[model samples]
Target: MDERLKTNLNLWNAMVPVHVDSKGYRVDKFRSGENHLFPIEREEVGDVRGKSLLHLQCHFGMDTMSWARLGANVTGLDFSEKAIEAACALSAELKIPARFLCSNIYDAPNVLSEKFDVVFTSYGALCWLPDLKKWGAVAAHFVKPGGIFYIAEFHPMTQVMANGGGVAHAGEAKKLELEYSYFSTAMREFPPGPDYSDHSVTLEHGSHEWMYTTAGVVSALLDAGLQIEMLHEHPVCCFQMFPFMVRIEGTRYWRIEGDPIPLTLSIKARKPL
Candidate 1:
């Protein structure tokens, strides 16, 4: 792994326990049957019943297991051993017929060689990758001919803004200010933010991240020979990636209320027949 990825992997390892306990991950809810996949995926990747699925960057496998629960023969991969371990444990407990592998997305072909009917990745997956074109090619390499590659991620336009940049709040909440850059570049280190659930048990680690514009993602996949099928821009977001964002309908967040400006986006592509 490169220095940037290595740094973030360490932070993700540290986050495993914290995230498991955090309400945002909702471990207890998952235990009860929450299935963390968003509705957009459920619909976009529809009819997964019995098809093979390869979920990349499958952090702890909640979504992967959910696919298994819905009847897809599923395998999930991630570079974080801690996350893979946790995913394996969850699979065993839930008895979800799924396989979990610990390997970097770039190295996965060497570790596990199998094509799938569906190649899928979801929210928060892309930023972890240092290379967009290579990532897209790797994704294309994993799906059988005529199979699909699907992703629903934060809009790259939204990514160009400062993460913590926001407007003022009235109460004790911290005020929003533009303190970071707005261009595509690798983040060498990020001070860990608050736990998604509890802010009290704070932890900080030097981490890494990257950026990919909308064109970067689409063109890469196209260059890799995945035909563009559907691309939908959503006004709602899955998380409050920015400070001024507000929750809209059905688990979606947005920077502005009563306005739709593509905060989230989803794409479906297929290999040539």
Candidate 2:
């Protein structure tokens, strides 16, 4: 693994236990038969009953097992050994019948040769990848002919704005600022900070991330020969991306007060039959 990816792997490995115990992941609720998946992905991916599905960057397999709950033969892959171990343990405990693999996404082809009926990945997944072209190819490689390739991810547009940008906080509103360039290919490093799932816990490891445009992501899949089906921009996101965002009642999703901008993007593409 590249040094940057290795660094990220360490960070993710540390995050596994934190996230598993965090309320955000809802591991307890999942144990009680609640589906951890958001409506956007469940609706878009549709029925997976009896289909083989591969989930990339699957952290501890909550979402992957959620698919298995819906009757998909699910397999999850992540680079973090701790994460894979947690996922396997959870699957065994629940008797969910899942296969969890520990390997970098780019190296998936070498370790696993089976094609699937669906290739799935979601939220906060793309930013971890340093190269979209190779990532797209890897995703396409596992997708059988006529199989679906689906992603519901954070919109790149949201990445340009500063965190809490343009959102009201403590009776004050701030205009959104472009804190990061939208088109830069440079790798960005982040210092250790509050874990996303558990804000009370500070991560011991820093990590690296990359920025990608919507066009760049779509083009990558197109270049890999997946036919574009539909791309949907959503005003609501699975988590609170901005500090001032409000959570939708009865759902895990959050959104800006007036829903001014797209927070999530979902795409469904298919390999040629």
Candidate 3:
């Protein structure tokens, strides 16, 4: 692993327990049969019953096990060993039959040989990967011929604005101020701190992340021989990505009330038979 990735792995390992206990992850509700998946993903990746599903960067396997609950044979993979162990424990305790793997996404092919009917990942996943082309190939590789790969993630544009820029803190007007580039040549590195899931835990190591343009992500998948099926951008995100955003009443969606920009993006691509 690259040194940066190792540091990220350590950060993620530290996050497992914190995330498991966090109310946002809904570990308790998940145990009570609530699916952790958002509506966009559930609807876009529709009816996974009886399908073989592979979830990459599946933190603690909540979504992976949710797919299993819907009748898909599921396998969840993450670079964090602690996360995978926790996932395995959850699977056993709930009797939700699912497989969990502790391997970096790039090395996944070397550890697991099976292709699946669906290859899935979501939310905060792509940024952790330093190389989008390699990540694309890994995604395309696991998707069986004719199978689909799906992702619902924060928009790249949002990342550009969200990267220490344009954030309206609490009690301030929500407005976008572009502080980061849409096409930067370098990866952004930051001192490790509280992550989105849990704010209580802090890490000792620095973190690394890369932002990808919408075109860049789409092109990589195309180059990997996956046909783009659907690409959708939504104005509301599943979480309050911006500090000043508010959750829409009676919905799991959040947005800056009057200031709307694309906050989330979803794509579905299919491998040809």
**Tens-digit lDDT track of model 3 for 1-273:** 899899889888887888898877889999998988888999999999999999999989999999998889999999999999999999999999999999999999999999999999999898898889989999999999999999998888887774332221222544666778899847888776665665556656667889898998998899999999999998878876777777789888888777467888999999999
Per-residue lDDT tens digits of candidate 1, residues 1-273?
A: 687788788878877887777776778998998878888888988989889999999989999999988889999999999999999998998887889999999998899889999999998888888888899999999989999999998777666544432221112333233444545465545676555445555556666777787888899899999998999887766666555567665563445565435677899999987
Clashing residue pairs, candidate 3? none
TM-scores, each model vs. reference:
0.89, 0.96, 0.94
* 1 or 3, greater by lDDT: 3
Give lDDT: candidate 1, residue 259: 46
lDDT of 2 by residue, 1-273 (tens): 899999999999999999999987889999999999999999999999999999999989999999999999999999999999999999999999999999999999999999999999999899999999999999999999999999999999888877632222112434345778888889988888778878778889999989889999999999999999989999998876677778899888898888888899999999999
- For each candidate, what is the lDDT? 0.80, 0.90, 0.87
Best by lDDT: 2
C-alpha-based local distance difference test score of model 3: 0.87
Worst 10 residues of 1 by lDDT: 164-173
- As for lDDT, the candidate ahead, 2 or 3, is 2
